[model samples]
Target: MVRKPLPDYYAALEIREEADEVTIKKAYRRLVLQWHPDRNPADRETAEEKIRLLNIAYETVTNPIKRETYDLQRAASSRKSKAKPRSAPRVEVPKEFMMTPLGYPECFVRSLGRRVVVHSRSDDPESNFQSFFASTKLALWWLPEVNNMCRIRKLGSKARGDKRGAAAGRAGGLNMAFDPQKAKTAGAEGSEVRMAPANKGQKADSVNFVTKASPTCEGALRFESASQRGQYLAFFPPSHLRVVPFLEEAEDRVLDFLFVDFASMFKFITLEEVLQPIFSAEEAGVWIELAKLQDDEAVKSHFKEVMGKDVWDVEDFQAYFEGHWATFEYNAEEKKARMRPKQERLAKQLRATPKAEEVVAAVAKTDESELQRLPVGALARALTALAKASSTDGEAGEATSAQIQLLAALRAVGKGEEEKCDIPAFELLHSAEKVLDLGGDNPDDTVLVQRSAAARILANKALKSASAIEGGMVEAGFTLPDVVRFLLLPGAAGRDLLLATSCVKLFEGRSIPEQREVLRTAKSRGSTNTAAAAGTALLKSLGGGGPGDHVAAPDAHVEMVAEVAECGVRLPAATALLRRMAATANPLKLAEALLALASRVGPGQAEDMTHIAESLASKGAFGNFPIKTILETVLASSKDDTLAALVVPAVPGHVYFALLVL
Candidate 1:
């Protein structure tokens, strides 16, 4: 007879009733991709119908209740087929099975309910029967298909109310056997039966034996007494009857006995549920062992599994492991102390070397003009060499030389003296400006040159506008001296003069004192070397003072004297201005200017001015000299001057004694 066709949806999807949602969805994606009408236009109509049916089957089977119902119907149909009588057909066992050591028994049942009869084992001894019953418990316990059928039957009876009374009777039997008092109390409320604990004084109603119905059978069978079945109804429930083992002999094995008793007590339990506690205990033990082996090869294996080989090669991973171990061994204070110096050393090395591609890029982009140049690739190589240099004293000497070369290159950039190099002048200028503006330990001389060059650039750019020049100079931290020097270059002198004159005019009222103070400070700081030269040049340009003409006083003498004196030293130009003033016919004004000029003259020059002093005395200008009056008028006022004046006793004493004698 031909087998009845499976449901069209099932056949379309090629899935069993037992297929899970994930399986169904997978099958659907595959079938839809293959047999969808769009994919197979030649079979469009049939493919479309198949696709529709597939969708319906997937939807129906994916729903839990619908899937379960479908499974039951399929199972019932299978059972009905097995129950039907069939004409005997010639059966041929596969030769491989016959050649195997284990032979078929007198009767054997296949998974699909096909049976084979063997006349040879039917009349076998009772001892063989006993042996078969002894080994069938594990086999019976593992038959999921048979257990599933039993579950469905039990559920079906309960749904019809017929199994409720039977279930209640079983629960009553269990209560009477193991928990009579609690059972009586629970019975009043019709509560569920509780399984007896292993330690409880309860004897198992039946012992399950592992038996093969035939030598060729792969699984075991289970049996229960008609009266004891109620007490162990959940364990040997009708749903589980197919796989139940017979009680033939008592075995002292705990696992075997426990499995039998457990199966009888919780008949409705799934195979997975039955094995859960034991498997969970085993899993927990395995985890404990795993945790204990954290430093073992197993841990390495696990790491390999989770992170792959590359993780161990990473610097961060190495650092973390090293740090972890270091921390474990050393206290916080020790660890900090040990790490601090090493970290600082590492950072120093990092800074000294260009570690990143971007830093290398920056170095490459640097533009060193004629005044400031360095080979970019050579610098990088030097840094890399320094990075690799040993920290030992001998190696350090070589490293130091390398460092000096690097610093020299940097300084050349600062000085704007390097040949056609790529270093950025603006960066060097800004760095120099920062150093000067912030004023720290004496900055490198190259830094000063850089500041000077930057000031010159800015001043030259701003030459037309005095405000712009001052703003640029001030922004660059250029001292007034720097401005003067920057402006003194051949092309810049005229603009410099204009700028200075404009500044004097603009701040004549509000900032004259500040301007004077800045010039005064610059003078004290000996920054007026350039300024003095520039002023003398400008005076000569105006024709008031000829070169080497000490007899003539320039028209600019008052301002020039103040500025030059503020410079705190007398150049030849300044001495010429002083000599002209002292020789004037207005001897009093001349003497005053003479004394002012004398005050600023260095001691070495003042010592050589004895005749000038005697001349001032003969003119009687010394008697009323501001120097001598200060000696008697205020003791404190003479304190500094008296000491300074004594260095040239002829100048001070002749003026003072001449006043007394007169």
Candidate 2:
């Protein structure tokens, strides 16, 4: 015959009975890698089959206890096969009869024990005995006995044969007709028989019978009624003895059932596996009590441990001991009692400040390293708050103190001096200005300090020359117009001043629609005020007038003459003023006044006069006509060389005189 192949699990991974877990694992790994689906996707079915077999073989051989059990079963099967005879067919006994064979003495004794008691009565004693014997035989057949060496006994007395029969008949079949001599002989031969009249209400005297007697049975019997003992009987043989094994099996089954129920109820996992990893002993105790409130001992014990000898009070537990720190304190009777209220009050005060949210968020997010390495957002917020507070008017003193504290903190964090906080400094100045403008209390003192601080910072940063700096100063309540004018003035000396001048010039040149764009561009380039100043200077240079004027007159006029004369440009000055008078029909007095002043000035003061005259001419002014006439006449009457040269040079005088005459 062809031998069947070993199972695929055994074949695939080459696992043997001797293989250890590591060996099994290595073999499984090798096989799995060779047949992995990703590596051999086209032949997936075959690969998957191989993988399944490998897993099964590895699992079986790697587990020591399972391997041992498998080995024992395999060995037993092999031994049984080897011991069987090949020539003869093996006779199989029913499992129930395997321990006892038919025709054995035990079998006959069992059959005898299987006899049931039977009763009969008749006027003839022989007929009554025969009937009883027939019923007993039928009972024995119905329930066969397993052992042959069994016995029976009959109790009570029997009468002599014919006379007993006659008495039994007379007594209405209640008496037995057994011969005492015969019963005595049977008893001597190891048989027992005795008879007497049945009791008044009973049908028969007594009966004893044996079937297959279990070791447990010392003549065990069950009776339907002691009063009707002759009515019926039932017997159990050695099978009754088997009840001990059956009962033992039942007890084991019951234990198994109980174990199964327990496994289902409690889950088949140890305390270590299911509970211990997740919770510490104390936590577990708390959890168990929480789960089962009816567990009074657990609840009480847990409360004591958590609340420190207090009776269980939910409010107290929650208030004082709910968290890991357990720093909170609670009194059961006084619900509001707490430890460290002052500290809590301080915390609340800190939180109630305007920048508290920002501080809290920053603090919450900061780790120890971050807090140490950088300025925490909280410090920034606190500084911002102090700056704001300092900027407010009535609160100046407190605010200044806060600012000092803020500066200390900044220095502690290595931010250097106060000028480092430019934005905050500017904001402080602006706030002071507002307070002062609104007539807030003692605003002057606050404004002065803030402006001084701002100026210092601006100087340090070289922002004074920046047009953007002007914008900031303007925001800080320095009037933009005044700031621009100040910047354009002659004495201004920084690059930021030049920049501011350039910005003002650009703004003036731009149309209304274009001005905002230009201003934005200047601001973006950090030159807003520079542009403004440049525009203002251009307007002034073009004789377009200052910011106070809408229309500007030509240079050949009274204001222009005054400007030119102030600059000592006497000719232009005299010409511009005389022309203005001629146009307006003014008298000669103003013209004469301008000429006289010009004539009195010596050559040594000529430069000064020129500067003053130029300035006056630029203002469109000239003097009165009488002085102009004198200047013309004098110029005309000059004699000879140098004097004539000097006289000829007074051309502004002649021009002024001619315009005045017009």
Per-candidate TM equals 0.23, 0.23
lDDT comparing candidate 2 with the true structure: 0.32
lDDT of each: 0.33, 0.32
Candidate 2, residues 1-662, lDDT tens digits: the string is: 12122243445677665665456556666666676544664564466456545544554454333343334333432331112111111122121111211111111111123222222121112332223332222111111232221112111112233243212322221122223233333331211222233322333223222222222212222121122212212212222111111121121111000001111111212111222232333432223322222234544443344223334245323321211011223343433223323233223223223342333333443344434332322334344444344244454554544444433333344333233332332333233222222213444444434433332223323223233444554333333343333333222344444445433434434343243333333333444344444333332443334333223333333343333333333343243333334333222333333444454445554543444333333433333324546454345334212122223333455575564675
RMSD to truth, every model: 31.6, 39.0
The positional error of residue 10 in candidate 1, measured at the CA in angstroms, is 58
Poorest 10 consecutive residues of model 1 by lDDT? 148-157
Show where candidate 1 strays beyond 4 Å: 1-418, 421-430, 435-522, 527-532, 538-559, 562-572, 578-589, 596-662
